[model samples]
Target: MAGTEGIDITRRNKKPRLLTDAERDQLDEFVDSIHYSSRYNDDHYEYRHVQLPKAMLKKIPKEYFDGGRGTLKLLWEDEWRGLGITQSLGWEHYEVHEPEPHILLFK
Candidate 1:
C-alpha cells in the first residue's frame, strides 16, 4: 500500500499482486475478524507467519504461502500482510495531496 516493490520494502515471496476494491473490502472484514499474531506466531523457516484464517487462505493463490517451510518462510498472503511488512520496515508514507487553504465552517 505504501511502497512500490523494492523501493522501501522488500518484495514478497510471490510476485506482487494488486487488490481490487471488492477484494480490499473483503480483506478488511476478514482482518477485523482475525486475531493474527505476526512476530510471535508459529515458525516458518527462519521467519514467522501472521497466522491467517484457513478458509480465507484457501482462496488465495498457493504461491502466496511458502509451502510449509520450517524457517525463513514468507507468510504474506493479502493486503494486510503487505501493509504490515511495509510499516515494519519503516517505509515512509508518500504525500497523497498538498494541503489546501483551510476553510472556516463556523464562527
Candidate 2:
C-alpha cells in the first residue's frame, strides 16, 4: 500500500481496486523527472564544498525541501545574516531592502 500507486475502492460486495502497471510506471517517471532537475539536486546533494551546519539545514521549509536551488539565491539581505551564514564562501555582500514593510504590532 505504501509504494503502490493506485486507487482502492471497496464496494459492498467486491474487492478493492488498484491502478494498472501502466499507471504506476507513469507516476514513477514523473517522480524521476522531478529529481533529475536542479532543484532536487540542490536539496539532496551533499554540499560538500560548503559543509552547512545541521541547524541551518533544519530551518529550511517544506516548500524548499525539493525545489529551491535558485530560490535560495534570492534571499533577503537581513535573512542571510540572521541565518548566521553567507552564500558561497567567497561572495561579496550586497545590501537589499524589502519592497514594503508593514508593522503588525506596536508593542
lDDT, candidates in the order shown:
0.34, 0.26
Candidate 1, pairs of clashing residues: 44-71, 45-70, 45-71, 45-72, 46-71, 46-72, 47-72
Q: Can you write out model 2's per-residue Cα lDDT over 1-107, one digit (the tens) per residue?
A: 01111211110113222334553343342232221111112432322122233333433432322242222222232333333333343222221112211100000
Weakest ten-residue segment in model 2 by summed lDDT: 98-107
Our tally of clashes for model 2 stands at 0
User: Each model's TM-score?
Assistant: 0.37, 0.23
Best-fitting candidate, scored by TM-score: 1
Which runs of model 1 end up more than 4 angstroms from their true locations?
1-14, 38-47, 59-87, 90-107
Please state the error at residue 8 of candidate 1 in Å.
20
Query: How much lDDT does candidate 2 score?
Result: 0.26
